[model samples]
Target: MATPRIDLTAAAMLLGLAAVWGGSFVFAEIALRELGPMTITLHRVGWAAPLLFVLVRLKRLALPRGWRIWGSYLVMGALNNAIPFTLIFWGQTALEGGLASILNATTAVFGAVVAGLLLRDEPLLPRKLIGAALGVLGVAVVVGADALGTLSLRNLAQLAVLAAALSYALASVWARVRLGDQPPLVNAFGMIAGSTVLMIPAALWSDGLPDLGLAPVTWAALAGLSLLSTVLAYLLYFAILRRAGAANLTLVTLLIPPFAIFLGWLVLGEALPASAWIGFAVIALGLLVTDGRAARALAARYFLHTVTKE
Candidate 1:
């Protein structure tokens, strides 16, 4: 039996999800200027909760009724959302925003490794191995050669951010292996609820109430972060994961740096350093190599569709 064609709309939706999520790093940077990492993460999880709950009620989707599902929610919630989100926010405090965004791209490399190591269904294939290698090289280029010396406490913080990326990558694979059949909202609520529970005391200890008195610009940034980056991003992400395989969905990270750098240039008036431009080119090349799209196009031109002599 012939396999049916994949839904192009679904692929486009997944791509849109990727673009929105790519902006999250910039949003985090904006929120961190006015709010501590814990505070920023707290507001996002807490504010989104009630809204997500209401969404569940409106959709008539039951909360995970079983402990098994609940446990999945808790574990996934922490790994997928809370811990990593907080790490990236704090790490960015010390690192250059662009460099931080570039480092975060390592999630694709980590995802491939994690999926290959843990998931029986997703063994490491030649393409995956090549893709993973290119991704790592891309990340290296994006971080620049000089930043290697900056690794210390700040470097450790950057690693923590990368760890967060790894956690997110692992969570994607884990959810597919474990919660593939669970509702998207359930997975979302789990992470949001778990992150909220974890952020409470941390928020209190890190900083007192975030100053709402900041310029309207700050408030606007906060709203943008919470709504577009956090709330909507999560929902769109899991929806994509549900439709496309996790492996396919995780490639979104590859494109994140470009969009992030573009937003930074447009909104923050930041110029892309020469190194950043070179890094961007390297990363783009790596993605092409990793996916074999370049090779595939060549094969189609020279080999695959060519007519043979009768």
Candidate 2:
């Protein structure tokens, strides 16, 4: 059998996924202007849930067999979607849009570290450690050194954003262990379901039905977030996960910062400071190192020779 080469379809899907997630921050900001964090989060979860359910049913995607998988999916949904979604919205409510994005970029570093600790087979390598450390340093730079000492509620809110990333990292590792074998659509559907159930009470108590008096722009942003960012982006993500594995798919976080920064500039007229650009570059480099593509090539060469000799 021949070794499989990466197809263009997968590449395009991944790119689209990255772009959607990157641009999500901008939409989140727009939505936040008129809606509370809980309200916006509910829109994302509630709308996407039914839409994804319809899509899953149309595709006839069956979930994995047994309660263990369903139970795990419920937990994964909370960690990956409900909690982080709410946290980022709340964090962004107090923080600058660009600053919140910079904080969200920490997801990859947290994912790598968490995966190493929680996963038995995926041990931490020296290179990955160095890469993750560099990525953290870049995040600090991107957020601007001046913002660190604000000593106000916003600072704490930014920390909450970081905490959300940490939770997502844990969720990623947990998903691999518990739900990796299930079809991508099934897993995605389960997550949307779980998030909907979890967010209902919070949305009702906090927002009490989205203030229908909001401007059309706010409604448009909410729609974009639910349909494009939450539903479509996740579909592409799950597709990539099925083809590429979670470890590889997760590396897209490295690409998200630059894309998010660019979108912020384009959509929101936000200016990127020099430090943020530098931080973006460093984070990208760190992700490349952690992915271990070069190591894989070298290993392939060594293994090929041994096999030939045998």
Candidate 3:
């Protein structure tokens, strides 16, 4: 069977997914002004879950009733949502949202490695190892070798972002293994619901019950974080996954950092160091390498497609 290529619509959705996911960092940053990291994390899944539940219901997808399935969703929730979201949100407390997104770009590289080790179908390719090394190098460049010397909050925050990437990678493997048979919308709802249940107590215990009174801007950020970044993003995510295959979806990982950096710069007046841009480029290169594509060929094909369409 031939591999499916992403057409215009899938590409657009893929871009949209990256934009919203990238904006997640900005939203978290905005909320962090008044909210604790745990509370922001909780707000994300807590608000998104019910929305997804409504979506699942409107779609009329049968919710899996098995505890075993819910058990998997719970694990998925921890790996995918609760842990990663909290880590990334907390990371943003110290790290620039742009840099966090750049470091988060390593998710695809780590995902390739983790998936290779865990899943039989995805064996360790030489390119992947090189790509993984490049990814590590990129991170080192971004965080600086000084981070290795001390356990400072900034260093820890950088580490936290990388940890979130690994969590996301594991979540993909778990979803493929455990929730592959469930409807995509159902799995989305299930995992978000599971994570919300887990996060409520975690947030309350860590941050106390959240204060409802907030600035209008913070509330807007929370709404955007919950609705656009989580709910709408997932819908776009699964739709693109179904249409373009999992491999093509990895392209979104590369697309996220730019939007994040742009939003950070344009809205928050944040500026990144040249090293950060260099690191992002390196990480992007690593991802393309891991995809086993010659950059030249990929560009050529894209240009050819554009010309043909024109």
Candidate 4:
């Protein structure tokens, strides 16, 4: 069976999700200036957990009581939050936010292959690879082709971000297979709670105690990271996962940088360069290739029109 594709609703949610998540790199960059990777990771999942809890209460979603489900939640938390968050935070210390985001776009390709292997219903490799390749090329172009070629001792940091991308890919597939029966809200809560539990101790042991007298800018960044990026992002993420399937959901990574550039242009009145607009076009083309619908429509229109005229 072909893998499920994202609908318009899912696509809009994904664009919004990508926009918020794009800022996470900036937020983590700011927050990491004063905080350890562990503490930053902790703060993200820790603070967001309660906000999700409040939302859950308002929605009257029942919390899962079973240990088995919680266990799966723990794994989800590790893959989706704890591991990736820590790695990316650390990786950003040595890499530019754009470069890190570029590296993270590998999630689309990784998700495509991983879901194909693990999810029986997802499409085989052939259909997804064309788009995955172009999505990656688009990311590299968006950030400038030279970004990926920058080699320093921080090659480890690049590896770290790539690992985080892989974790994200795995988390997408795992959520589909393991937590498919649970409500998205419950799964969001349980996963955040599980990460919070794991993070608190790890942070304390690694970072000791966070300095309470943080700069206001740092505080603002932390709040943005937790409230917008984590809280809202989790909700949108699981919604996309449920609606679009794992492979399509991961394409959000490819969309992130474009939205980031667009937001800068729109909100800050920053001018977009030729490359930025070109990159966005390329990214859209890649997404179209992945969806496979636009290509069919184009072929039917132009090819058939030409044949009829001939």
Q: Largest TM-score belongs to which candidate? A: 3
Writing each residue's lDDT as its tens digit, candidate 4 over 125-238 gives 565777677766665565565657786646778778878988998998999899989888888899999999999999999999878899999999899899999888878887
Question: Could you tell which candidate, 2 or 3, scores higher by TM-score?
Answer: 3
Q: Can you write out model 1's per-residue Cα lDDT over 176-217, one digit (the tens) per residue?
A: 877778678866776688778888888888897666677676
Which 10 residues in a row give candidate 1 its minimum summed lDDT? 1-10
Model 1 RMSD in Å is 3.2
lDDT for every model?
Answer: 0.72, 0.80, 0.92, 0.80
| Models, CA RMSD each | 3.2, 3.9, 4.0, 4.4
Clashes per model (N, Cα, C within 3 A): 1, 0, 0, 0
TM-score ranking of the models? 3, 2, 1, 4
> What TM-score does each of the candidates earn?
0.84, 0.86, 0.93, 0.80
Model 2: CA > 4 A from native? 1-6, 63-68, 146-150, 242-248, 294-310
Residue-by-residue lDDT tens digits, candidate 2, 1-310: 4333336776777778878887788889999888888888888888888888788789888756678777887898899998999999899877666667777777776578788888988799887797788878877777667777776777778788888989898988888888878777778889878877888888889888657888999988888889988899987887786676666676677667667778888888887678767887777777767777867888999999999999
Candidate that would win on lDDT: 3
- The weakest ten consecutive residues by lDDT in model 4 span 263-272
Error of 2 at 110 (Å): 2.0
